[model samples]
Target: MSHFNDFNNPQVAALPGHLKQFIVDQHYEHYTPIDHAVWRYVMRQNYSYLKDVAYYPYIPGLTKAGLTIERIPDLQEMNNALAKIGWGAVTVDGFIPPAAFMEYQAYRVLVIAADIRQLKHIEYTPAPDIIHESAGHAPIIADKDYHEYLSYFGSIGAKAMFSAQDFELYEAIRALSILKEMPDADEEEIKKADELVTYRQENMGEPSEMALLSRLHWWTVEYGLIGTLDQPKIYGAGLLSSIGESSSCMNPEVEKLWYTIDALKYSYDITKPQPQLFVTPTFQNLINVLEEFANTMSFRRGGAYGLTKAVESKNTCTAVYSSGLQVSGTITEFKVDKHDNPYFIKTTGPTILAVDNKLLKGHGKDHHKDGFSSPVGKLKNADLPLEDLSADQLKDLGIIVGVQAKLDFESGVTVNGTVKNILSSTEKIQLITFTNCTVTDKKGHILFDPSWGGYDMAVGEKIVSVFCGAADKEAFEEIVYKSKTETHHADYDWKTRELHKLYQQVRNCRLKQGDYGFLGNVWQKLQHDHHDDWLCALEILEMLEHEHIEPALTAEIRQFLGQKATDEPELKKLISDGFYLIAHPVEQNLVF
Candidate 1:
């Protein structure tokens, strides 16, 4: 409740004069002691588990980002570290829109949420927080390739568009997050917020272009893994940040599928633990699959295809069809025929246009709205009412008689009865034709006789549940997170922090004699596996060229430089200059 950044002020988000309104100050002082405690507990829990199991660069990236267990990180201080590695950090109140977030990523800025989850939600927070953003995402940004991959992915993702319905879901997410963050939010308010989320999800229907892009984002960035399925390691931010889900996701029972382009077909749920995780063999594989997936999207191509892609990408746009007709609006609904192919695009402007399976232009299906489920059981085959039908006439028209029918009552309750006849309304505004049915009370006495009459509500009869509809299948198989109580510690043998410090010293020309052996081992370890880390070791060798250096070590440096050096011109120059400095003791003015 402390007014950090004046969070309680209704106009705080509208503050002017900033480079971007979404970026906010960390407001470190606003976090109470309990908040700090939660940060520490979650950090310690996650770091201990991730130091060994997470992506190879995560621990080093954490240390290089200048983060510690001491307190929550100040974005400015974190930026100081990130700047060394060609990245930076920024803070936001909570979740930003998908496009805004991707745009930030494209610019190499981490969009961290300033708030921390309360103790009750320590294991997971549905909203973005310091733990999920800084602790979860920051550590891996230090790696050159992984960071570049993020930049490329973000650039492609920034072009995506979404339907108006998708925006509604996003707004619901923002609303729910704000409600959860409120210090005095009551249970009733929380339930209402949860229901809003559920309503949005239910209405989203099948995967649209934007939804598919989100699925890709979720699988790789949120809950992705790296390494072979038989021996997957945690790399995704979701696993890197969570205490419970991290350990749970790595269990053998969880389905660890090999990361492939087909991974795009899957959908995920944020409310539950993932039942399946896609594992890439390396960070480079993430880049490969992402590029492949991006190529398949229509938005990047621009056209009718691009139009769909634009809608998929979460942007509202004005586009001209081949007929030279232009339409501008947010896409609201989409539908496919029974074959599960896209057949129509509906906009909130109340416009519906038909597009073939390949997204080619087609005339609007005038009855497109009829495809949707309606209160009157989606009137089909005939526009006329089924009233004034005798028992024989009803049977002739394929109307099933003697079925239990449900009707909305005046008291907001639904009651069922056996159908006897059909009748039409005579009122000026005839609500709906009704079926005469026999209604019996609990005592088995018939309270009402069967008769045709005008009714105020639409009537529907319960039928056998059909589960094979195009959209009836579960979007994603439910995943369970089985929590563990055991505390974890960093596997000290890996020396993530030590390697980070050594690398920094090399960058700063501060390496000492005692560090040579460790540097030698690190160089050897990185030479075959990591081009970037190997280059850092070479830089350290270049810095070590001095008068006081031992002849044996100098010889070792020269030998490795000669045999393992690449044809890269900059590397060749660094090596040539390093040997020259070793030769001319007084001419040691060159920078490392």
Candidate 2:
């Protein structure tokens, strides 16, 4: 039996089996003290800088979202806080498929990646880590209109039809993200993974529904700005979480465009900073753009075009007939009529017939183990569409059970057999089973032979809708998008573990644990053994300067950091930022 821990969150518990498959244990104990330190540094910096520029009051929003500047958030704590707002959170291993991610959002559950970025990449990491997921995404959701926009986008995104190439691209990106985040990852391997991502992205022909929707999401949810283009404030999670980009995005070089359907025309590279951003006047405008785009998706516009998209997906999808019957399978081929309407569709492998997203009794994949095929258009001589016909209407056409019938369709397809069963749901004809049946098309090419056993023909005036995944995913046993690549968890070396201990010591000292003397000892160890470390010493200096206890020790630590900053150009800004935040405390912008 598979076990899933929902962390006692109602929204998480309500998730379907297929979606639950993606949920993993948060294992809050696995977070090292150093990891907490990294979280603290990012949160502190974000609060310091984002207070003026962030869309919402950054510090107060963090509290509302169950976060703090002192530590990495515990998942249960986050869930409890989010529950008040009718939301929940869960941890995933790493990058999940975009479709699955969107579905989680639709369920009002945040999928957080529990890992924190390495200390070396403290400023910004391409990987999706705790800082990016919880700090960047969870806090901003406190805004009602913004959260509503997110949930709305999720609902639309969950139904978007994704192509096979889209899956390939997602996998490539996942692999690349995981590799880049791994501290010991090889440069050559990273290069190869990046190339694969580029290859998949470039090769994906005419973007699928999911691809286009992802573009909109990237612009509005991940890297969007709010207010006027000239004086916009940061709202996007990507900007909120990345201390490096949040400051740089304000530069005039990062082109800002008015958010609209036009944003879909722009693609994004996740590995680098966004070259451009979209600005929305209000959060409701974001939903307007999403609604406008959702109208164009295959799920909303069902026909030959929709079926063609489903077939191209090469994944399990469902096509809904006008009769309200649903056929779920991997659509392999679809034949169009002279007017370009789909007349017949075929699934090559296991198929299930459903109505209103419930599987039909005795018509599951077990019964139709091979495939299913049927004509879609109206009969040549029928007064009404097949589904609209009543019992009397069907008997007039000789389509009743236990009757021999030869049915001809307007598209020149014929079904010749003995009608064994006629299935109807909610007064609409849905399925017709035939024994010893032979089906043929206009050119006399046999569609189905008697040797293939009973033929179950789906009844519909036409295929009215087609969308991604099974109509009833649990019933279909569809596990959509399980990635093979796993995130690399670092096994800390003894020396690294010692460094974490020193950081932990300082954290304890800052909590007023009467361990002020430990600072001098920790500073001595850093100078003698860990010459390159700067953040730990910086924290120590902050404590000393605050208390004014050891002027000589404070001056010495400050001199060390200044020298280190000058020696390492990359560490210069981080050291200075630490200095600046200490001197210039950001006022607590908290909301009640």
Candidate 3:
């Protein structure tokens, strides 16, 4: 296996340092035989039921996505197949931050969770897993329209401005998911974590752009439906991966509504099955709705509204000026003019002045370690906008180099200094640095004092946009990559290990055609020792029933499964479904 920041796939290789930090080794050897059994069970169930209802053809997509109905997919193999379709796969421990997840999609890559769902939570698991990420998401990537919408959504989601409350809610969800996945997690502990999640969700106080976008993502990407509302087909990764919900979500009582901008108004509870789902007629409509919602985000609508979101976020974000200058920092405050346009903005700590997402030389965080404050808006006496004025135009206005310049803005901000240097891009003035500069607003608030060293005034007619993260993320060094919380890995007890051995013996029998007598032996062991376990018995029964040999042993195993189903309510559907698939094969019914 390759080490850190190494992947054979080109798409995976192209990831930046920050994203690479989230990648973890798949450790394929760690998956026990029981784990493979769980994966096999879920895939078989999904394929049998989903072939007719899934938007993408189920069987063919399996091969196309580098998956199998037989076992947990090899991550490297999945990447090789995904690469053919302009996509690649990488494994992360569990749930990653949403922004980073979207950014991965923007790069045409899939973020698969390394862990597989436990057998106990076979039907449905709250946490993300290999089944959900690889099987549920990859197959659908074969559709051109759907994949296009997916990548576009990623691009938009990457730029969405999220708030501090959004991060709180995200952490809460992550914690709860980790707790729920642990085999020995306490009920009381789970309840407390769940309550905290619900509380944070309810108290987020008006969702930010990223919060609202997450709703759209949940409704569409995770739980979305397609085709007519009367008979919408399953396409979402959440629905396709969940054996329980994949069937239940199709019930008429679940309430399928048309997908639209109103999806932003709907929120989701990760702990429960969705009571309602949104249906789109086509993948193109998904993009249309996303575009509509994006127009309302701070990334598209700048000035006061956008900057206010940045301040509320209390995290690193970027603000774009009309002059094409990018200011990346944690904005602490902004002052607006009488017309509600942001005329000045301030950052609390290290900041970067960038253009076109590239860091400007000598204008990095170290140079502005104390923070940055810059005045915006048009000059009071300039003919053209300050940003558009050429060198000749600026000199004509007496704003020449090596001269003491006094510039006044219509918004009543004033700058007095000796012109030291000017930075422009394609005739647009991006920044103006000065020595012994003093900046003050109309109300005599000293925004910048001469004692603070050289002043770099950002030039723009208006603040054009605002978004989450630094414009040049590599330059900003996104150290907030690895999550503080980790998904729990359960240590199987001796009894569980013995059960795994039985499962492995069954798999070897099917793959090698080793022995029919061993099936009888395994069945007897299951009846005397691991009597409560049904999956192992089911696998043994499958081989016996397929060969039409060991009739007496087959009947005995069948009786045990029937009785177990009756005793365990949760296993009823699973047992019955397995029986139906065995009797009615999707294809030649190979020995898996």
Candidate 4:
């Protein structure tokens, strides 16, 4: 029987020159027959399944490292093999703190354990035994980039633990590590343990936090896989350690996305197999990712003041605000249908202020007359009918009908130009210009109807709508003129040109006469005719008259142009001419 030693002392002697040397110096014993058998069994089972599924780099790494399914590896021998690749494994008693772990890796030592659990205990070992620590984690340490990443993780982890604000994130990482080692632990028990950790931290003046940890662990360790577009593979320890996760993570259902540092830092899911895995095109790409992460997360530094404050404030305010809001009223009833839209918190409260559809100004004001009345008032009431009722009466009797104002802002920007001129205008528009748009109030509601026929309006327009509607045209025109006066015309012209190019592509594809293949052929011809200058082709088509084109060909072109004109009217017009040219053989011959 082995006793777990306390490896937390900062004054402990530095880890030995190499992991293997440390193991030998510490008098770490060799594995017993049972230990060797367990190692072989795990190695065989995991490798046999992983040989095909493991990252291509890992396949040779295991073989080149001489890690086989025969027996437990001798630490010295394994270290000798690893030494060629600038890595070695050191045996330890059990789990180590983040600081110690970092220190070991910072010195190029990969930590391992020297004992295996009994067969009966294998399924439920609360802590990592030798087999899990050494065989499961060691071989991959031989890879250079991976080894560096591990060292980086250690450094980051150690720094994170010292901060008061990052305590919750730290706990979440620890909890994940604990959970990974003890997969058999009940979900309720795990939740209870998390709660306990959170409680203890809060009592000690540490705010409980874990969402970021969950995201980091999920993307970097659990179910993480990386490779080039041509050859994607697994490198994450969680996937490397387990056969099933490795295979499942690469499935089509698990979406693969480009690896951006911001994406890794902010968003990731840990519960299910990841919906997306970042695919790095090369080892250099991995380095780039690390560099980006270091730069963005300030990984080289100890802690970020702004991030710390945000996390701390969010943690404290969420609990306080949720409690207060819940007391205002419980949602007694709700209704949502195909076209009716969903209604929230329909309840028998004090009748507040109610208004009819006419009160709302916009296109659909008369079509739908749905609204609500909430008795909550703040410092300012924006032109609402609040004068009739007294303060006391207002609290008891205020009703809001039609679409309620969920979020109100002073102004916004709109990109307005003819479809032909949009691209040129885009380049000319100032970056500061705000778009005036209204969003739908319901969940997943559209803020603005980009598909609306009159979406392209003047710039600097202040749009006011009940739901996805614009303010009056006169008001919009005034704002647009003001914005244009302040903005450079060249920038707007550049934007217009860019929009023109996009519209050209959509119009070309849409204005095709037949199937995709047939349309593609026609597009090829048009491209060839205009020396591949789509803009010139559109201009030529727009110049042709309907009488100059055949009816059948014109119909086909019109159908195609219809789809393209939605956002790119210039393309639509071009395709329309192409249809006419195709329909009228005499005109086509004359043009040719």
Candidate 5:
């Protein structure tokens, strides 16, 4: 029998190497016959119901994505089908962090859970499974407009960081998802997980931006309706994937409301079918409402609200203090001290005295015997409303809002210039700069929106690089790192060396090929070593089939064939994973 713990650890260990942390392998062989049977059962049943009641795009999208009611779909293979439409699928181990999930979508990559629900949870699994992720979510990406909206939503959603309390809510839900999927979890563990979930629900105050966005996703992407209230069609992934939900959601008993931004008012329970749903008249309306709501978020609207959110989201940010020093970090907290002092916030990564309260000046020094202080008055820097300041006034304080900004592509320099027209889009900030243009050829033309390059920014804030000619996004990151109160060091060379060693090990495997011993050794690393090397092993195995080698080397390699070895299914399957990749390479595109 399949165990819940197995589901919790369903990620195919070797796939998502360092750069592609969002991906994993499906480990197709791990699925039991029962798993495939359940998939077929659900697909066959749901297809009939969906064809009649589902949204027009649902069926066509599914077909375009090459999904069929046969067996459980391989995410890599699905990516192949999705490739024609400029999208790709990647497998994940159950649920990942919400922000991470959004980031993947921003890159046009679909994150699908690798595990299939057990027979017992066929109707609905509180935990995400292959059926929910691949079947429910993947098909919709086939629609170009819908795909754009989904990714745009992800870009905005990624910006909504959580408060410490709200982050706890996120962690609690993550814990619950894992615990509920742990087959051997004792009664005590279950009790603890249940308490956390309950606590999060009971204590949650006015929904944070992250929470509200989640509610919107649940209503629309997960269980939404489209068309008129009287003649609604099933479009939500939750409804399309579930035979039970698909049929029940459209029944007269369920309350259907026209989808609006106000839908954020209602909270949802993932454990049961939603009692009410919001229906949209058209897909374009979804994008409009989403973009409008996103603008109201703290990241888009600079000031205390924007800074506070950036801190909670743990996004690296640059801020100027009254004393003129700038600092950036993976911000951990944004709160007033007990003294009701709101002059300074706290950071965890590289501790520095941010604001000196006694002197009332921002200090960039690493040492802080008397704790951090602010360079500017608390009210002036963060407490003041954003609307109170003009573009030039904010610019004087080193704050760049929507204005004609000078961008130095060569030096990565950006500064406030003159005010120009502002443009709007679902994914990013768009604006035209005039008068003081450095790019002579494109003067009076629109500067590129940084969001197109995945640069996280405040609502009205335009990026002005301090460095000259550093047009790439790396230049922007370098500016933040350089401005930090202390250097944040990472040992890149050492990490690269270790990865190179793993590649050498894969190369060394060719010498021990007797009875597939070389393959088994690769299997061991795939199971035990770090993920970065997993891809190297797969690539090595994929290449070994045709590479000519000494016959003597082959004979010597066979010596270990008679050695007894334990048969671990996962390891055994991993040894052969290369063949699958050869057939279906994960193809991803940069959708800026």
Candidate 6:
């Protein structure tokens, strides 16, 4: 692979002042008013929802980095804010090629687009626009560890270009990783895709290798994860750059998995909402993982074999067995076939099921019955000993059982049984219960209903609460009461007078722009509905009412408001309570 100089090392001088100045010189014309509004809307909505779910580091980093629900920041201004923590933003057009993207990261400059999609087009935008790239990713860039990990990622991508074997391995691992996460991904298809990747790597030239590397880049860097001990936070540019994905990753329904290099390299699925996310203990851990992989370039040649082993160990593939059946023909065209079929039975791992022919035609189920059909009579465990065979003979017998084998000895009596049952006669179910939990059967019908007071619930069963009516005082107390005293105030205390000043400033701004109809009549609605906090509403209205307001001006306004909101207690409370009073009508109108 081609080696590139690491731009993040201290030996590389800090960004030139002129380059920084050039980015600052870019005007508000670069971003349309609609873009600013979208930025404001998205930042506001996402921040509110993320307050409880986001990692503590992200919450403060966002605020401290000066991101607010008011405007799309100038690249230069954003850089200035991030420079405090040794990070900054760079402007780029939509998506960059993998090589180019890596080059940008190598420089410690995250490329953020400057445009934004309209509210209606937000979710379905075809590419990364300014709002998605900058707002979604820039704030987190301020974190030191995250920044370093990205730098390493760039280095890996750059080097992978040199070796065809390494590139193919990278692609196969990435494809497997992403496919495992996608909901629509077919297991058989995934197996096929992995097999194809392996085959191509073993046979292809540089062009094919490069193509696979590109695919890997798309899946991992643009759409991968940074798992930490506390949580699996998003680091991939795709997730970091998209508002929907950022919030979606934190939902309770999204399953979380422990972080391991092997799990990421061998079993990740990308096309669907991940059933599980791997969390890393720290950014250093992330760096360590990548670094270990990076140093193992020589060993990476055995990618297919390693993946097969991993798949087998994880039990990700199906198992099949058959007996007393003339199961001829090699396990031809097996999934994960590196080159030609190497004796289908000998091929271990997920593809092991392809060895037996009887199992291929729906062997075990009873076909005549409504459920399943079986062609052979059932085999009992006690019947096996009477056959008394050698160890190798018994081994073959085991394989037959796995394939759902039917035995026909001297007599014409036939017997069939599952290897799973033969190995273990009975299954055990463990039950766990929690206080105040409700229990439901496999069909979802309630088996045990907990009273309003509370009740015990069985393990391995679904529990859902039914609120028959408005909660009573006792119920409210049970839910809300805490053992320790809680402080219901901002972490940093602010003077009441300062908050009032901010409120007045915002209110005045809104009043000045109350006549303009842009932003879906935001100013007009604020005048009518938020008469009480008209001043603060007016401020927001004025800031957004103009068609060509400069980003710098917007940044100033946001900084002032952020400071006042932090310094003034009463004003902060008021702003927090009714920040959207004027924008409510606009929101309602837009929702429909």
Root-mean-square deviation of candidate 5: 18.3
lDDT of 1 at 349: 29
Worst 10 residues of 4 by lDDT: 480-489
Runs in model 3 with CA error above 4 Å? 589-592
lDDT of 1 by residue, 224-306 (tens): 88878888888789888887788888787789898888887786767779989998888888888887877665543433355
If both were scored by lDDT, which would come out higher, candidate 1 or candidate 6? 1
Model 3 CA lDDT for position 136: 93
lDDT of 5 at 274: 80
Q: Give the Cα RMSD of candidate 4.
A: 34.7
- What ranges in model 6 sit over 4 Å off? 1-27, 63-66, 162-237, 250-253, 263-276, 298-592
In model 3, the clashing pairs are none
Residue 579 shift from truth in candidate 4, angstroms:
65
What is the TM-score of each predicted model, taking all chains together?
0.52, 0.97, 0.97, 0.40, 0.56, 0.41
What are the per-residue Cα lDDT tens digits for candidate 6 across 1-592?
0322222333123533222321222346644433454565566555554444444354456654556556666655565566666655665434343444554566666665444564444442444466666656666676677778777676554333233343345455445544543435598977886776667555644332224444444444554555443455565555654556666777778666555455434333333455545565566776676666555431132223322322222211121212212111111121222242111222121121111122322222221111110111112332442223333554565523334443332222333333222211112111111233333322344433435222211111111111110112121111111112111111223443343444444444444554323433443343355333323442453455343454554454445555556876545633442345334422322221
User: How should the candidates be ordered by lDDT, best one leading?
Assistant: 3, 2, 1, 5, 6, 4
Deviation in Å, model 3, residue 242 alpha carbon: 0.9
lDDT of each: 0.55, 0.88, 0.88, 0.39, 0.54, 0.41
Residues 257-364, candidate 3, lDDT per residue (tens digit)? 999998888888887889999999989999999999888889999989999889989999999999999999999999887789888999989999999999999988
Residue 7 C-alpha lDDT in model 5: 23
In model 5, the Cα lDDT at residue 465 comes to 14
lDDT of 5 by residue, 1-592 (tens): 1211112122222112221443445678766544665675566456545667877645466666667665688655676677777676667666666655665666666777788875555677777788888778877777777788888887777556454465566566666666666555578977887787888887877667778888888888888888999998877888877766787777778999999998988998776788888999988889999988877875555445555655555544444332322334444444343443233344444322222111112222233322221111222243333224444554765445444544322122232344444322333222222334332211333332333221211122221111111112222222211111111112335554455455445544433443343544554554464542333444444444345443443332222221111243333322333334334332212100
